[model samples]
Target: MIKGDSLMFRGRLRGTALWGGSLLLAGCMLNIFLQAASLGMKFGAVADWVARYPALYLAGSLFLFFLLLLFAALVPGGYPGPLLAVAVVVLLGTADNRKLATTGEPLFPWDLMLLKNAGEMRHITRGMLSPLWIAIAAALIVLLLYGMRKLPKVRMRLTWRLLLGGVSAALAGGFLFVVGSGSSLASSLHYENLYWNQKVNYTQNGFLFAFAGNLHQNVMEKPDGYSREAILRIAAKYGGNGSEAANPAPTGGTQAEQDAKMPDILFMMDEAFFDPTRLPGYSFSADPLVFIHGAAKSSPSGYLLSPEFGGNTANVEFEALTGLSMYFLNDGSVPFQQRLVKMSSLPSIVSILKQRGYAALALHPFDDTFYNRNRVYPMLGFDRFTSEKDLPKAARMTPGGYISDLAAVQEAVRELRASKGPAFLHLVTMQNHFPFTSGKNGPNTIAVSGGKEAYRKELETYAQDTKLTDEALAELAKELKELPRRTVAVFWGDHLPALSAGIYAEAGWDAKPRLKHETKLMLLANFDIGAEGTGTLSPAFLGPEVFRRAGLAEPPFYQLLDRVKAELPGLSGSVRIGSGGNEIRKLTPEQEALLSDYRLVEYDLLEGKQYSAKLMF
Candidate 1:
């Protein structure tokens, strides 16, 4: 019934639609295949192994397609399946690649929080675009756009369309619900089973499955042996009756006399700042930590055994603030993101100081949202929190793209000056954070005496950056000297700088993770507040020690800390520093008993019921 010209036109349109649609579908499949192959390759999987692992590609495609379908239904789009599928592949692949390169671990659900905070993203290294992937993605996008125009649109009745869309959404929702509840299945799986070492689980089960498995593990349980009676028995041994009594007046003075002598106490956690001269075979042209050395002579100063190395500043802060050791918690789990969420009351240094009329302020020269600190601070009992957003101006950054330590000190001093009465300020600086490469540092100001040329540049950069922080310390001390109110400052490095593998080998430190974990600590006060004999102390003990030196009423756990410090001067999840030196040695019977008690108390506060906390605090 149609004319020759009209029939031919219709035939051409049909052919174009078929070819474009084919191209789009093929592109989506190819994108998923490539991404799965890339993830496999990261774990040293060969081509043969990847060819055998068909389920990975299939599961990824199905989940991705369902997500796209749900997104399309929510909007007015009519099946953006291919485009969205390709997008999911590219984005996830890119993020996983970058995370693996930086942290040597695959991306997990917690990392999503980091991506939401733009300021925290600065800490991560941005990956460059792969030309092959980019070219393929571009081709897919073009094909998708072309197909969208020519493809025949199937018209459905309005009611049918709505019903079909709802069905699609319900299917997606149901699948997600299954995933959330499938933890028991994962527990039974062979290599994919959740364990203490999360890296192993990720390697065995693949990133997607392992991430879901971790979500189930987030719910902490009581220790293997936990009872209120046992907790009380331990508390009684330490002279703690577990009563919330008002702080008794000082033995030698009245409450008014104590008030007159109370000083503004500040705890400053300097990031990646350490005494690099501790290296076995390295020497510098001049002393890098000249100021710290001078301070050590007069003030209470020594090494501190940090719970982590290079990163995990939050954990070190956790132990210092709350007297809980990461050693007892799941390995590499973030307390702020994981455990702290469930806690309503944390017996932290901030809270202890607050009980004695000190306004507690939390200060950090970075995003308030990183590690969910803005939320966590309230639970820790901070009166106010000042982050980069609250600073007078945007933070002044170093060449390494971190906020300068000098600027952070200035901000802390400003806040202290503004506070009305005795204050407890916790400040975390960012100047000396990791990746000590030439690009990050301005210039090699310090000269290295011995090292391969490859390591010399990086070492010099770290040393130079450390010197800058030391200079900032000197500046801070000068500023504190001028403050009208008596002030006590606790300055300590969070952990050592993350150096290159070659440098560690050259310095004879390759086999020693414990020695590498040591960082310096110094407690200095403008007025004479007597604190004696500091060889090394764990971060947990540091808080009570600071309170004692500042003439504040001790927390209920002070007795426990004193006993532990007498035998084990420093201890963490990994390393211990005793009178001899840093070592990964077994705990003595005496030490074990103390550790058992410490663990029980911490368990009660963080994980178990709060019956013990009420008595203790």
Candidate 2:
């Protein structure tokens, strides 16, 4: 009986050892696969990473192992928990790789909010999930489940399982809190947080660590010395009551005459529009933006520095409409999604125009629910919001499954004609959105030479789309010129196209952040305004600039923007341009003071009490 008991005890001990070894092996495999996905399947790079930072690599593996254990402790079956954890890591890693490749941006914690709009994202992710990938994913899931069923299960009491789960959760939560807080513990572990450029941050630090760091990003913090009195002092410095001094009244004009002279204002934010010719190593058959180039020559036109590069059109719109710089907000935070949803009402160009008797209308030839624009447009004081649902079937048709710029402009003109008086029309077009596959709009007229065949095809398609937009604008200009009522239009590109990073590298386009973020802007009017070029300016400054050019009254906040513009013409989170259109490496004392004041005003309006709103707006 003693000999039999000894043999059974030995067998039980061996089973425990086998289970522990298997868990360790699974953990190591999960880490390898994750790193492979993060590095785009570059095995050599993974080896270099392991060799360079062995300690970090081991720590990352252990971190992932603890997470796997957390799942295992909660799950009844031994293998199912680890398998589920592996599947999740695989999905996220592959998604991060794909996003970085296509959008020139890395995945962030805030990006999870996009899952709510997955149906709308089909247009952007058209070819991402091919039949082959779907089949492979299904097969892997089935295999994992089957393998889990075949594996041996370890029996443990419910109490011990719960205790293990609790411990694992505590450890994971503690790690995330320390890393997310930007504490010295994370720094001592060589975890770098590169807020400005997240792609590099993820590549340098592991993806798990880098992604955790953005969990606690403050959307907008109160600027130093921000208070009601300080805001009043700044407002008084500019103009006490948000007067129209910056926009002087035409001589010998009555108030009614001045009101009548205020032209119908149209803001045309074209999607993904930029001059491809500016990128070196690419030759086009003809100038794609012929009409735009011609209009720029005789009107107020220059490069508008966009805060975003590939996507996030709404942020650019927010800056232009509200005159609030994205530079002041946390990086990767979407104000429309994160901040605007909480506020009941906000001061904007739309609200100001509505107060001045100009009917405010917002038009987008796409789903209204995109970026939650349907709910937020009313908060911005738009009297009418039109989307694809409101348009006729004939007007909504397009070759690429997106409404054409011509169709959108036609709709805008129709709205303007129906309005009883002067109107403020904000039209956001959707012709040149992402996934610029070849032949989407039939044969491409623009021939692109110099990049890989795939990139060349994408460039060709993008250029043709922009050409169509230019043609539409030319038609709009002709129509506006014939109208009896004078009108002023501000047309600008929201951001650059999501082309391949390799294309930009080959063209030397990635040498400067400014070059990557710069897009075209033109201020055109049916009647003659002055021949003042905007030079280089941010979207936040565009509204004030438009008011100045059109002889419209500028509010106190806009007046402050004017002062800021005088010192720093262009300001983004990453780059700043001086008044002379040169990039500023360091700020002068006066420039610093102006920036501080700008920050305080922006903070008060966006985050603080209504102390400045009555004075500035």
Q: After superposition, which runs of candidate 2 have C-alpha atoms over 4 Å from their true positions? A: 1-24, 32-59, 73-75, 127-139, 145-149, 152-161, 183-188, 192-197, 242-259, 392-400, 450-452, 482-485
| Consecutive 10-residue window with the lowest summed lDDT within model 2 | 242-251
Model 2, 105-181: lDDT tens digits are 67777677777777777676776655866887899899888878898887768987898789888887887898888
- Candidate 2 lands at a TM-score of 0.88
Alpha-carbon deviation at 161 in model 1, angstroms: 8.1
RMSD per model, one decimal: 5.2, 3.7
Q: Rate the local accuracy (lDDT) of all candidates.
A: 0.70, 0.81
Candidate 2 accuracy as lDDT: 0.81
Stretches > 4 Å off in candidate 1:
1-43, 46-79, 123-184, 246-256, 279-283, 393-402, 417-420, 434-444, 449-455, 498-502, 505-510, 528-533, 548-553, 577-584
In model 1, pairs of residues that clash are 242-615
For model 1, residues 503-572, the per-residue Cα lDDT tens digits are 7778776577666777888887778866564777778888777767877666567778777777777776
**Residue 496 alpha-carbon offset, candidate 2, angstroms:** 1.4
